[model samples]
Target: MTAETNEVKQTTKGADAVDEAIAQGIDFDGSPIPPAKLELYHKVMALEANRQRSGVSNTMRSRIVRIGAKHIPQAELDKMLIDAGFAPLKDKEAAFFYGGK
Candidate 1:
């Protein structure tokens, strides 16, 4: 919450009444994913679902790391992909974002 990067953030617990049911996580119908992971999930899903609509993957990961929450470790990105319904398409991707078991 710095002055420069000020943005409204929604918590999974205490959002507005409209978000009460969803709890502010990435809501895929009724499933609630954490905000950090869910943010990436939405973007990945969107890219896959409508590839022509978004030419963003080339720089998407770098941009996300720059703008996304500082607490979301880079390692979590791959799992976020999996949870969002896919796996990293390349070894470089896996090396960068793979979450250890």
Candidate 2:
């Protein structure tokens, strides 16, 4: 391919990973992300950005628990939390997040 056909690509690392993915039109799995999906994502994120700020640490913890539970085992996640100087999961959180398993 010539220079005209070569598009500059962003490195999918660090804080700008999502932006890089959007610019490249590809997901981490190497599959092309649909433009419509990207559009909707941008729309929702724009709304989120404009939303009122609460506790930033609270938000981070909530997100970690919500997404982490999906990928990490209960014991492992508890260990990670404690290792990171955060409290381990509460009873209610354990029930809600790890209930099925």
Candidate 3:
């Protein structure tokens, strides 16, 4: 794999490694890192912080569904939602009106 992908995978898998890499001033690639990539990394770190703060288990799925019934004729999304502890949309209108709420 490329260094960028390796860096991203390592960052995701090991926080300590990411910190060590940062402390060592190791760049993901030979090029200078862009501000946008740093911003995205910070956002991911913030998300991790928020996840810890909320005491929300990462294994628990959110009780929000986005797929409308009409768009998904097989009802697979509904079944998945129900299995994930989310209420299925009863109708297309209701699904569209409150989808993701």
Which of the numbered candidates is closest to the native, going by highest TM-score? 2
What is the model-wide C-alpha lDDT for candidate 2?
0.81
Cα error, candidate 1, residue 43 (Å): 30
* lDDT-sorted candidate list, best first: 2, 3, 1
TM-score of each: 0.23, 0.57, 0.31
Better of 1 and 2 by TM-score: 2
Local distance difference test, candidate 3: 0.55
- Give the true-structure RMSD of model 3: 8.2
lDDT of each: 0.48, 0.81, 0.55
Show how many residue pairs clash in every candidate, following the order shown.
Answer: 0, 0, 0
lDDT tens readout by residue for model 3, 1-101? 78776765566444376565554445544345566776788789889777634335322323233333434543676687677666554687455644555
Q: What are the root-mean-square deviations of the candidates from the true structure over C-alphas?
A: 14.0, 4.7, 8.2
* lDDT (tens digit, per residue) of candidate 2 on 1-101: 44423332334556677787787788765678998998998899999999998787778778788889998999999999889877789999999999988
Cα displacement (angstroms), candidate 3, residue 30, comes to: 9.0
RMSD of 2: 4.7
Top candidate (lDDT): 2
- Ranked candidates, highest TM-score first: 2, 3, 1
- How many backbone clashes are present in model 3? 0
